[model samples]
Structure formats: C-alpha cells, structure tokens
Target: MSGTLGPAPGRIAYAELDVFAAYGSFLVQDDTARPDTSRAFITDLMNNLVATTDGAISVGTARRRILPVTLDVRTEAPEDNLDDWDHVTEAGLRITSGRLVVSTFDYRTAIPRTTVPPGDYTARTYASGFDTISDDRIHGDDAYRVILWPGPTVEPRVLKRYPHLPIPG
Candidate 1:
C-alpha cells in the first residue's frame, strides 16, 4: 500500500525537523520527551538525516523557515531520486503503535494519523535547496520528502551530502 501526506507548507522554522515519529496512540497527542539539542545530537541528526530515540524519530531539514513537506508510506522501498535532491539519507524506525504522525518540532500543525501496520520500517528522507538556504530570508523552494517502508532496522546512511551545509558537531 502507498499513501502520501502533504507537499503543503508547514509551521516549522528551524532546520532540524520536518517530520518526526509521534509517540502515542493519537495523532495530535505525543507523550514522548523531546531529545536534547546538544552538539553531538545535532551533528548526528544532520549527518544521518534521521535520528531516533526511544521517544521519537526526527528528520532534519535544509531550510530554517516554513517550507512544504511530504510524507509517504509504501509497501517497499522506492528508488532514490538523488538528482532531484540536494541531500538524501535513510534510517530505521520502529512503530509499536500503528499511528504515524508527521509534524514539525512543535505539534501545532500536523498531518493526521497515517496508519501503517506496527513494525520496523526504513525511512528515507530527501531534502532540496540547501545550496540556497539563507539565514536572513525565507526561500519557498526548500522542501522535504520522507518515505517509509516496512524493513529491518539498519544503521543510518547518507546517500548524498551537500558540503556547504554546516553540521553542528
């Protein structure tokens, strides 16, 4: 089965979260504690593109302002579109609860619960516009796409990396 949620604009203004695993049975309610934004943590997050703790699985962003984001769930892995993206990475995520909620760092704006059978899955995150990302302005071209499919947990890998983007650590 395949499903997609949003290429619509989101409320996230930070460069670290475009989509994340929500730790609860409900879509809008997440009971998981937020991860610390330490130098090591941020470095790991940016390098892998997907970072997970017991509480959450976060996908990093290339832009630090509001941008469109999309989430896709598939029955199998999709081909990586490296030419279309500036950065691409993959990681593992286990969903004990069938509810998959895609949202920003804050829960204010979120995609409704996307149901997938509870299991381990691989999440591939694709990001674009890192080359033109700005600290002082918002560029509408920055976007993120996260695709998840059922699979064994594996070490995170960066398929494509943009050298100019800063890694916290």
Candidate 2:
C-alpha cells in the first residue's frame, strides 16, 4: 500500500499481511531516504488495523497484503446492515483472540527493517470499515484521516465449510 500523508487529518494507510514470514516490508517518507522514519507495528486484534504517520508532508509506500483479505460473495452484505457493507472474515477471526503481524521495511532499500511481532498492537475496527477510514475520529485523536484498502487475497482460503459430511463406511 502506497500513499501520501498530509497535514492535520493526515491519512493513515494500512495493509493487512497474511504471509508465512516477515521478510519483505517497507516504508518511505517524503519520497526520500529518511532513516528510521520507517516502522512496523502489529495490532493485537484484527479490527481497525492501521499504519500511523506524523501528519507531515510525507509519502509512504508499503508492500504487503491489504485489509478485507476475504469477502464472501454469498454473504458479502450483512443482513443487519442494508448499505451493502462488505463483510470481512479475518476481522472477526482475530477479534476473539489473535494478532495481526506487521512488518515494516525501508522504502529506499525495500527490505524488512522492522518487525512488529504479536502482542504489541491494538487494531481498532471502524464502524464504517473501509469507507470510514477517511472520517475523523469522534473521541481522542483526530489528527489522522485513515484510508484502508483490501488488497487481493494472498493464498486465498476457504472461509466457510460445508456442514454436511457423509460418514465413510
């Protein structure tokens, strides 16, 4: 995920990664080689995961799997909601218990520079999901305008399994 962060109400972009290892991840600031400006942090939960910025004139380019990792076409839209809000499976997967491992790399070198291991982050699920990423938060901090995009599923898996299984004699 690549984007630019502007002044107050800065955009915080994030990419959800579902990979085996954290070998390739990076962040570039101002389109220049700003050492240490890049960082990697994972959320304890899968909800509301984000990449933070300092609300400055900076550009960030991240390489990894984006959010909304999987969408159930059959159940894409929830019944409770009537606006066709897409349902994300992974979000609920870790909500109960799990962590979203994030690895941030240096944009200049495009190499894994930092690894935000499990249990170091707190992912917050937005009420509007991807659509509300840009909306300002009501409470505490509102300096950031988040933008989230669900990148193509990596190694897509079967989210829902059939209930019927014939017993083999």
Candidate 3:
C-alpha cells in the first residue's frame, strides 16, 4: 500500500507507489536543492501529484473517469463499475461516500535539467482487459494520460486468476 490513504478503496484513492518513489533515485546536487524541497509538508502535498501519470482513475476502458466526491473510493469498490471519475476530477466535490482511485491524472514528474520535457512525459499503460480511455479523462484540473504497458501492476490480479484464461500477449 502506498499509504493509509490508498487501502480504503474509493474514498481517498491512490496509485501504486513505485512510479513516484522512483523520483528519489535522482540526485539533485547540493547547490541544486530548492528551498521548497526542504519543507516536509510541501513534499507530502506534492507526493500524490508526483506519483500520478495523469491523475485520474483508469480501468478497462478507464471505467471510472469522473468520480463523484460523494462516492468514496476509500471504503468500497464501485457499485457496478462505471465512469464517474470524470466528474470529480474536473469538479472537486465534498465527498460523502466513495473514494476515487486516479493515478493517471494525479501523477507528475519534475523538469530534468536535460533537453527532455521539463515535466513528466506521457507514457500510456497497455492492458487487454481495459478499454481505451476517453479524452475527457485526459483533460481538466486533475487529469493525466498514460499508454498501457503490459505488467501485473497494470493488468491487476483480479482478472489474472483464471489459469485457463491466457494473459494478454
């Protein structure tokens, strides 16, 4: 679990941590360290955005795009798996029930000193189970984009359990 925030389900959503933690691998020279980086609160606040690719929850077809603040992903799975993330990502809501899990919209990267793009580059994850995400999920205040890459982290364990069912190639 990335933190206590992730396990609840849909209320306070979270992505797998490896993506953001990887940032630590980069070493800013002593002189390069920004004053802001020294503050623990600022670091905590940016952690989620840094971890997310685009910032929105995506699934088979990115099933849940506009999430309702009322529905908390923190405690439960979707009632029936729907596209609700689009609503919340675009419109931050006063949550009452479920939590939303959005890694695509929430994740971000820093501008490397190199010629590459200053911030995180878009790289989608590939999966057979999920449908292609819609443009709505790619835009807005808390939205991001990721090309699907083949991996257990992307595919999820729920769909891979059937031994008879071959994993997507």
Candidate 4:
C-alpha cells in the first residue's frame, strides 16, 4: 500500500518517455545521457526533482463585458469554489481567530470562435477568498493585505475566512 509522497508505489518503477523529456530541462551535464541503464535512471532522477519545485504560472482576467449574441444564454449560479479552481493552501499554524471577508472575481477569455469566424467572447464571475489566503501566509507582527482585481480566479480567492480552531470545549 503506497502512493505519492510516501512508500514507493510498486516494484520496477516503470515510467514514460515524456516524463524524461519534461525533466530534461534540469540536467546539468548537457547531452550526457547514454543509451543504456543510465538513460532510465537519469530520466527518473530528473523527473523527481521537477516534481519538487514550486514555480507556477497564472493568467490574468479582466472586467466582464456583455456582448450581443444570436443564441440565447443566461448566467447560471456557479458553486462556491472552495477548493482547486481557486487555491486555499495553508503553511503555518496560528493561535487566534480573525475577521471574515469575501470578495468576487471575474474571468474572461475571448478568442476566435469556431462557428462565428470573426467573433468570440467569454466571461465569468465568482466569489473568492484571495485575501484570506494572503493573510494566512503572513507570519509577521504587522500584517496587512491589498486587494487585487482582475487576478487569476485561483490565485487570491480567499483571504482571512478560516480562523484558528478553538480549544476543545
């Protein structure tokens, strides 16, 4: 019984070639992979390192702009994004409860449409806790946060919602 971040999954760690290609970026000895046992070992080693890095990329969103359309479509209520689509990662422990505040985010991605050769548009809006996330990550005496608009929906959705759990009653 094993999985990621724990005991090895299984015997004979089989892997795909693309995994090797992906980790090739971290190689120090350029063009040094010989076609033998060494190749498989190097690929797996590089992939392991790539999985540990924390770098990430995000796209920005803009204000919603209603567009004139032929087909009829109405906005529907979306579920509260308390998980993945938005990030709610915590790193440290706190000893107190804080204020609660919620914010909204809008996402729009417009490009060439498939049917409409010369027209395309996209828009979305949702509540988030970006501020809560930022505040939680702060480990300093003087803590503060500035609101950011048109940011990636997942980046700053929650700010300070979940306060520290109280002692057992």
The global C-alpha lDDT for each of the candidates, from Candidate 1 onward, is 0.56, 0.22, 0.22, 0.18
Best by TM-score: 1
For candidate 2, list the clashing residue pairs, or say none.
25-105, 26-105, 44-121, 47-124, 48-124, 48-125
- lDDT by residue (1-169, candidate 2, tens digit) is 2212222232223333332112212221122222233433222111122223321111111112222221111112122321332221112111112212222332434422222121211221121232233223222211111122222222211122112211110
Candidate 2 structure, TM-score to reference: 0.19
> TM-score for all predictions?
0.69, 0.19, 0.17, 0.14
User: Which runs in model 3 stand beyond 4 Å of their true positions?
Assistant: 1-10, 13-73, 82-169
lDDT of 4 at 159: 23
Question: RMSD, model 4, all Cα superposed?
Answer: 23.2
RMSD of each: 8.2, 17.7, 16.9, 23.2
Where model 2 places Cα greater than 4 Å from the true spot, the runs are 1-29, 32-41, 44-46, 55-104, 109-169
Write the residue-wise lDDT of candidate 1 on 143-168 in tens digits.
67677777876677788876675342
> Lowest summed-lDDT stretch of 10 residues in model 4?
50-59
Best by lDDT: 1
